[model samples]
Target: MLLLTAVACLLNTVVAAGGLQSCLHTRLSPASTLVSPSSAEYPNATVSNNLSWQYFASAVVFVGSAEDAAIAVKCAAASKIPVTPRGGRHSYASFGSGGRNGSFVVDVTRLQSFSYDPKTTYATVGAGFRLGNLALALDAHGRATPHGTCTFVGIGGHATCGGYGLTSRLWGLLVDQIVRVTAVTAAGDVVEASPSKHSDLLWAISGAAPSFAVVLSFTIRTYPQPASTSYFDFDFGNFSDTPSLAVKALLAFQSFAATSAPPELGTQFTVGRSAGGTLGLRLSGVYYGVETAIPTVIQPLLDAIPFSPISNTSKLQGYMASVAFLGGDDPVNTTGRVESPNTAYEKSIIVPTSAPLSEETWTKFVEFAFNTPVPPGISSYYWQIDAFGGSYRGKRTAMAAFPSDANAFGGRDGLLLMQHGTYSDTSGSYPAGGHAFANSFAGTITETVRTEGKKIEAYQCYVDPLLSADEAHALYFGHEKTHKLKALKHKWDPARVFDYPHAF
Candidate 1:
């Protein structure tokens, strides 16, 4: 009779276990719809910018509101399952969807909503609003906020990660424009962060966003549209034979940017392999003043070059039109091309004004661009150098909202940001060798910068997946600030619930 009772008790335990599994697999919150792997929405929810890092989630919580997001976090905590919040899904390192083995992804793209207060000159923006839609909305009000060039990138990631755009020099980083942010904490509490409230989280989210909390919305200070804007494009064809002249011209431009270029001017220099395997350099930017001022600012760069540019074009247009023009899109309407999913690897570094540009480093960069073997469907790899010292220069010390001492962004002290990128088509599987070569080339460039140019820091937004947590912390936050970030992290998320590659 005892043996019979033991068997019956064992059966009852199994039945209870199965019932608990059924309950856990179903909806966890009234505000969120939990979609299992069997649901068709699972595929779309798991998509990321880089196909190489695509992952399947155990379940996706389609959060309808910030309250729903809070509930979802609580559910994940109860189940002891990891959770990641996804916005536009544009993380090159796949921080949004990758590396979360069987984790729950809270899709916040459904929370896109915005409101502008004309009197206060502040716009309350939903975290899920894409840059293009936000741009249009602000343009309707004759106001604008500084943002990144890519249109499809979500405001949450961009602003939190230190957004930069054509007007960033004149204004400030997207984070600088933010007056307030609302986020859901790891403790499953909805909190508002700003200079006055939950201030530590506010400082951390300004740059190291993914490591802190799930941002729900931001209140950003907006500026009135510029009266007139002008743009100039200069193309310097194959510099293989006359590389010296190109170098001289580049240095001259850099000098002008550091010493002469006004806050209203923004410039980007690109060096890459053009069609037919020829090396080329292109300089492009916009001036916030009238068309007449273009000559005064750009003439010094023109004079430095020994040879004339193959093409030079300048035009006057509205602020939004200039944005479209700079993005290589239609000027009448400020809409950028929707970037399709493709394989890409990027490395970015901050070049301080003190770092001297050596001939060896320049030659090495040129040779790598020309000699790197492109894959079957790949077109070309490129480098972009953006000027940063302008009105932004003062914000490093003057901005009280995000005190310079506590801010996590590492590029504020640099004169320019140099980005190296490798591109591959999405039509076929990404070649393993191609990615390897790109990483090698990027490492070579970084080493050269450190050994020759004496610049050891890198931009945090261009997150590299291969970096060790320690190395990434130093690169992104510097030694002093990294310690502060760690203390804050321990205070808010002691369990390290929100994590990814290079996360704080």
Candidate 2:
């Protein structure tokens, strides 16, 4: 029923208006810049990476402009080589790992650019633009987009994989604002996908992996700047002792946030390493308007588990500055950057909004995440859940292609359950052993969650390889939607030019 046709694309020399020669040129005059594998800068270029905690590509091609990227993609096609687009590489999955298949790495760093059309209220951004840079750019214009807390994370890939962050409760999703995308299709054609043109391609790109093509730029809808943004933090040492309290707190806050939380207020939850050796459970947020109304909105959550007020720096700063605080000032700035030389695998699940959260599942999850013995440098994470529902609750357009029950995703107004197991060091003698350990831990968690009668639909880019095809389908597209996705794959990338490890 599926056709994996390998169509041969014909290269051409039609230069775009006043640009450089196309990839079909025989003389191959070097453009403004080119970092080849044999060049002196190759070693350094190949090793560069954002935080995702792994190394991947053996060779890296740092593309400077869309034209340069177009050339690279064309060259790869001509040479019969595979290509992987590189952004922040922040995912924990092997999605960007190129592996040993000799996939040419196309790094979009040189494509970083951000500009706005005030009249239209849109931000035309380069594929390489990180949330931090974009936030700074947007702040200059008194405009903002719902880029997540990690400032340095790439917006290109983030938008496609249904970008989310603390602000999700306020702005819906980062992808919701996407108006148009300029990309090079697998067929070697430079095209634009948007609501007006190539709408289906646009649909496939959002909430989907980079299977359609290599996106060079995205033009997204922007919103007026909020009057002010606020931040809050709380720390609890032992997670297991307050199960009932935490549940009651979570439930009460969920109800309040849905009905009464000021539209200006956006909240977040995080359970991980904090300022001290203490592993903290913190609830922090941003208020788009006056901060005076936030305390009332979050009071229910606060009442559940009172702890030492580690630090509460609530202020009326620009969105960019708020992003800096949310991302925190870290050494590697791992809060939002991608991993270089991508080496690890990422896994995530969108827990249904209506799906019941059993005490058994919660207790088991907390134990595995906090009590599990993680390798020294290696780490795992659990995101804050306080930030959900707001404008993001009813974006049926976003769930258009998602095979699962839209309601299951917290009733289409669901809270996303994000988790990842990261390996910081892959060169040690215990490399295989470390992977085995993480896998075992993950299996236990998955099994336990399954035993409780819940399902996990992963972000396409974060589907775990350990899952069998059927298992992956169930985890990713829900039981019924997986088949439809396969059909989409057949309709678009029949030749599988954008294929990666199990990217069907």
Candidate 3:
């Protein structure tokens, strides 16, 4: 959300004091306070889930409630400062911190409130609550909702940007679960957007929220926990070294997922190099059904692949156990967040079921993944594709069983969401070719598809900071959606107060 200042933010100490005092003067709730650049807490306030854009914020107001959020926004506007709403602080491009200095951040992570209604099966979660905590809290009542695997991701941005959970195939994207949202608009109005109220605003906030408002809370629908699941893991060690075999296996997996995979299955394919530079591919997923049925479903697909798995296994797990297993850790932290921030660059591509990745695209994917050599100053790199598989043979719904016009989320027809990322060895620094290295995959895909008279998209959740505003908006949301969003943006934020690069 970096404002287009070609140079860095001006560091006039007066600007900080003026903005901080303006909000504090409003008498924020007892628990709310503003942290200035001079404060000892400034460093922590400027950080989110990523280290790449740990820019110096002009001030951060840790809002305790929706009222506090409104006050922070109004105060920032009065002081002529930009507002960046900080939730779990996990904007890969650091939109939570504006990706630049002089950002007046409304830190909402302190407003951790949760309440559930057993009678209605609805959960009203404060925007501050992390996904992990939400999972645990809902599990206590034997209820759950769709969300990302990363526990620390805030429900606000996650839902706003098409949150894709492991259970999304069975349920739907997190945005589909959002029945209501309470927010502070550009004009400092405390409002609630829902199906029955502010309906248009509700549609915008459901996906492109940052372009319009600072969402304070979300009321979402929840479901009963899964009775049982079979967590399957398949390893094809160093298989990518042989492009032909890897391509064949990858195509087999993709074919099974796109054609015959059931709604209960959630699978991801990952190809990366080992410590010794051995390229390999791994396939893992969760089948939200009886454990014994695993072989009935996955076994045939495994047999179809040209490259045999080095080892394959499946384990029975209940709802919470399976979530923890796939997430790499139990979402447990009593005092603070669970984090290991990285100096990373990210890119994404959304593969639709309508046109599937063609032979040219798959061949290019194999080439980029295996034949490409690691560049200098890159600590780690890998690309993983999550197939949002469902019953998609034209008889049922699309991704997550939602219609294309369901909300602002543009990937409703996606069969796969591909993430290309590279981590720098040193914090806050990226190699010269780092951007190009990760961009190559999606870049090549776009080129191949265009020649065939088709267009492609990238997953908005995995934000690519390098793309121009127009390009990002167009790819993430199509020309039609972009125009619609821009019109809505003009209506809601005519002054462009809630401004960000690539935000409509």
Off by over 4 Å in 1: 1-31, 274-276, 327-339, 370-377, 390-403, 426-428
lDDT of 2 at 343: 42
Selected candidate, larger TM-score, 1 vs 2: 1
lDDT of 3 by residue, 250-348 (tens): 787778777677777788888776333778788898998988788878877888887778898888989888777766753533236457778888888
lDDT of 1: 0.73
Could you tell me the TM-score of candidate 2? 0.78
Query: Sorted by TM-score, highest first, which candidate order results?
Result: 3, 1, 2
lDDT per residue, candidate 2, 42-65, as tens digits? 555545332333343434566666
Q: What TM-score do all the candidates reach, one by one?
A: 0.88, 0.78, 0.94
Q: Cα lDDT for residue 173, model 1?
A: 78
Write down the TM-score for model 3.
0.94
Clashes of each: 0, 27, 0
